[model samples]
Target: QAQIVELQKQLEEVTRARDGFQTELEQAQKSNTELTENNRGLTANIDKLSRAQHEMLQRARRADEALRVLEGEKEAADRAQGSANTKLATQEKQLKTFLEANEALESDLRKQMQRVALLERRKLEQEAEQSTIEAYYQARLDEMQAQYDRLLSEIDDSKRAAQQEVYRAFDDNAKIVPPSPGGGRSPPGKAR
Candidate 1:
């Protein structure tokens, strides 16, 4: 009976040890299941993060293309502005040249007008001088004509007296006297 008691105590200790090992196994299995579920959740979140990262990359590429297009447009605009500035400078130069030409023409016109005024004044002076000369000549001519008429009248009077004396002498003597060549001779139907 002493051996039997000792054997019984050893069996009871072995049985308790087996039950404890079984309970530990069940707890281990439960902990593994919870850990597996947590792993699955973490995998799903990683997948979503990966997709978000891909979408962000696509958006970045589109933004880069848009920036390139805007830069092209800006370059074109800068070229157009440069061309316009060149055209404006050319036009301004042309306008300046035209204004200078107009000023030169105006100066030439003023000079020509002054010349014409001088010529007109000279013409008037020449006409006035010619008129004075003509008047003086006419006055001299009239004076000479008056003197010639007076001399002609005196010559007629002398000729008539000489002819009367010669006729009276010839009538008293009853002698024929020759008529002088320069006597008061008159043509037919005309008086001396």
Candidate 2:
């Protein structure tokens, strides 16, 4: 009976140890399943972060191209402004020169007007002097023509008086002389 009891106790201890090992195996299997699920979640998060980084790089490249285009436009605008400034200065200088030339022409015109007035005054004075000389010569010609007409009248009167006196002497001699048979007058100083 004593040997049988000792064997029975030994058997009970072996059975307990077997149950403890089975519990430990079940707990280890559960921990391994949890670790696998966490690893899959971490991989999905890493893929998302990589896609976001690629999108950010593409946006930065587009911004750089836009900045270069804007800088080129600004340089062209500056060159156009410089050309406009140069043209404005040239036009201003030309306007000033034209104004100066116009002023000089006005002064020359005034001088010519003064010369024309002086010449006109001199011509009027010469015409007045010529009129006076013509009037003096016309008066002298009228006096000479009146003296010639008086001399011609006196010569005609003297010739008519001498012819009347000769006719009277012939008549007186004819009365003093008598008619002869020849029917002619006697001599000029004697009676018939």
Candidate 3:
């Protein structure tokens, strides 16, 4: 009986171990099902990512082509700008030359005008001096003519006085003469 009891105890222990193993197996199967569902969702996400990557690649190619066209336009514009700058520099030099010439001409004109003014002043002074000389000579000539007229008048007065004195002397001598013989008798060579 004691041996039989020992054998029964061993069988019960084995039975408990088997039950524990069966529960462990069921839990492992449930965990596997969840892992499988997770894997399917991951695969669907991978498919979406692949489509997005293809679209992005196509857009990148088109962007590169547009960048090349814009670069070519920029090069043409730079060439045009260089030519315009050269022309502007040449025009500025010509303008500077023209301004210098104009200034020189203005300076020369001012000098010529000053010379003309000086000559005109000299001419006016000379004309005034000539007029003064002419007036002085005319006054001297008038004074000389007045003195000559007075001298001629004095000579005429002296000649008339001498003639009158001689007539008076002849009358006085006749009054003082003695009676001729026989009151009207003829003197020698007298007609009777």
Candidate 4:
């Protein structure tokens, strides 16, 4: 009976050890399953990161290209501005020369106007002098014509008086003298 009790106690100890080993195996399997799930999640995250990095590289290349184009446009604008400045400077010089020439022309026009005015005044003075001379000469001619008419009338009257005196003398001589042999009287100064 003591051997039988010792065998029963040994059987109970064997059963407890088997239960402990079974519990340890179940815990190990649970840990392995959790590790596998974590690895799959990490792989998925790595794939997403690779895609994002590719997109960023393409964006960087495009940004570099846009910068190059902007730089070319800036150079073109600078050249155009330089050309415009040169044209403006040339136009300013031409304007200055035109203004100076216009001023000189105006001065010459003023001088010419003054000379014309002076000549007009001189011409007016000459006309007035000529009119005065004509009036004076016309008066002198009228006086001379009147004097000539009076002298001609006086000479005509003197000739008529002399002829009447000679006739009276002839009549007186005829009365005093006798008749001639031929019955004709002789002229006052002739002998028959």
Q: Give the lDDT of residue 154 in candidate 2.
A: 44
Clashing pairs in 3: none
**What is the C-alpha local distance difference test score of each model?**
0.56, 0.51, 0.53, 0.54
Candidate 2 per-residue lDDT, tens place, 1-192, comes to: 343344445445444544454454445445445544544554454455445444544544454454455445545545777766565455445545545554554555455455545545554554555455445544544444444444344445545565676687777556565678657776678887
| Candidate 1 segments exceeding 4 Å error | 1-82, 162-192
Which ranges in model 2 have alpha carbons more than 4 Å from their true place? 1-83, 158-192
The residue-by-residue lDDT of candidate 1 on 56-142, one tens digit each, is 556555555555555555556557886566655554565555456555545655554565555455556655655565555555445
Candidate 4 lDDT over residue span 89-171, tens digit each:
55456545545555554565455456555545555565565455555555544554454454445545555666776787777
Task: State candidate 2's TM-score.
Answer: 0.36
Model 1, clash count?
Answer: 0
Best candidate, lDDT? 1
At residue 118, candidate 2 shows an lDDT of: 53
lDDT of 2 at 127: 50
- The alpha-carbon lDDT assigned to residue 143 of candidate 2 equals 45
Ranking under lDDT, best-scoring first? 1, 4, 3, 2
Q: Is candidate 2 or candidate 3 better by lDDT?
A: 3
**Prediction 2 global C-alpha lDDT:** 0.51
